[model samples]
Target: MIEMFGLEALSNSAQAATTVGIVFTEAIALYIGYGAVTQIVHQATREFLGGE
Candidate 1:
């Protein structure tokens, strides 16, 4: 099964590191994306509320 996935070429530690790196990258991307969305929503709310 591992060979079918082409992951058999990688050592166990290498596979583990790759998984961790992928997860970390995804987390950072989500954090930044959510921050931008939250900022946009907050700004829109403030404008609707007549706040400076």
Candidate 2:
């Protein structure tokens, strides 16, 4: 896709760095998203069970 964007001059190291950065960012996003969903489910379950 980067090459398709006319960035054929982009170096291999730059591409590797960009890939790593993107993976890291996506991992963080998924972690945060799942954490939020888990918190919501936990709260609902607790309420249903008559806990605080």
Candidate 3:
């Protein structure tokens, strides 16, 4: 199944490490993306809601 994804055949430990690294990268990107989105939306809403 994994080979279908075009990754080289890796040992179990290597696969585990790669999975962990990918998961961590995804988490950081998601958090940063959402945090910036929320901050922008919050400021825009505050101004619009406050009529300022």
Top candidate on lDDT is 1
Candidate 2 local lDDT, 1-52, one digit each (tens): 5564465577989877776777798899999999999999999999999999
Q: What ranges in model 3 sit over 4 Å off?
A: 1-5
Model 3 C-alpha lDDT per residue in residues 1-52, reported as the tens digit of each score: 3465555588888877777787798899999999999999999999989955
Q: Clash pairs of candidate 2?
A: none
Give lDDT tens digits, candidate 1, residues 1-52. Answer: 4455577679999877777777798899999999999999999999999998
lDDT of each: 0.85, 0.84, 0.82
How many steric overlaps are in each model, in order?
Answer: 0, 0, 0
Off by over 4 Å in 1: 1-8
| Candidate 3 displacement at residue 11 in angstroms | 0.3
Q: After superposition, how far is residue 41 of candidate 3 from its true place, in Å?
A: 0.4
